[model samples]
Target: MRTYNIHEAKTHLSRLIEQALKGEGFLIAKAGKPLVKVTALGKPEASSTRRLGFMAGRMRVPDDFNRIGADEVRKLFEDDA
Candidate 1:
């Protein structure tokens, strides 16, 4: 698209924002008519692989989840007194 008019987008604003962060989007006129369309903002992409179960069955894992607090933690280390 490459338009850049306002004084060549203020003298090539940092190489047109590094070519619009590499996706190459452009258009910023003011006297030639366009207006603004710099681009580059959709960034949600950082998964690096870590989806073991992702909540498999959605919920429910109580097989005494490690002995549901085993007898009040064995009576707080019993010494009964």
Candidate 2:
């Protein structure tokens, strides 16, 4: 963890950003009061990976999924109205 005054942080923003990229937490101060904290951004997680444990190998795909042509889809829309 590190702290920087407003002027110091403005003057050394690049260094602070480098530190944040390296996973260091930082606090910025304005008029000697803490104003902001900075941390590294997390990498986006995959939806499939997030579905693990509860979703372990339980997906289903019907053969009819590929057989549904555009004409059949249009019929579904016409029947719904």
> Per-residue lDDT for 22-74 in model 2, tens only?
99979998887899999988866776357447655787767788776978777
Candidate 1, clashing residue pairs? none
Candidate 1 global Cα RMSD: 9.9
Candidate 1: C-alpha lDDT? 0.85
Worst 10 residues of 2 by lDDT: 47-56
Which stretches of model 2 miss by more than 4 angstroms?
Answer: 46-81
TM-score, per-candidate, Cα-based: 0.29, 0.52
Question: Which ten residues in a row are the worst by lDDT in model 1?
Answer: 41-50
Off by over 4 Å in 1: 4-22, 28-34, 45-53, 57-81
- Top candidate, metric TM-score: 2
Q: Write the per-residue lDDT of candidate 1 for residues 1-81, one digit (tens) a residue.
A: 778798978987998988888899898989799978888877766664558877889999988799998898898899585
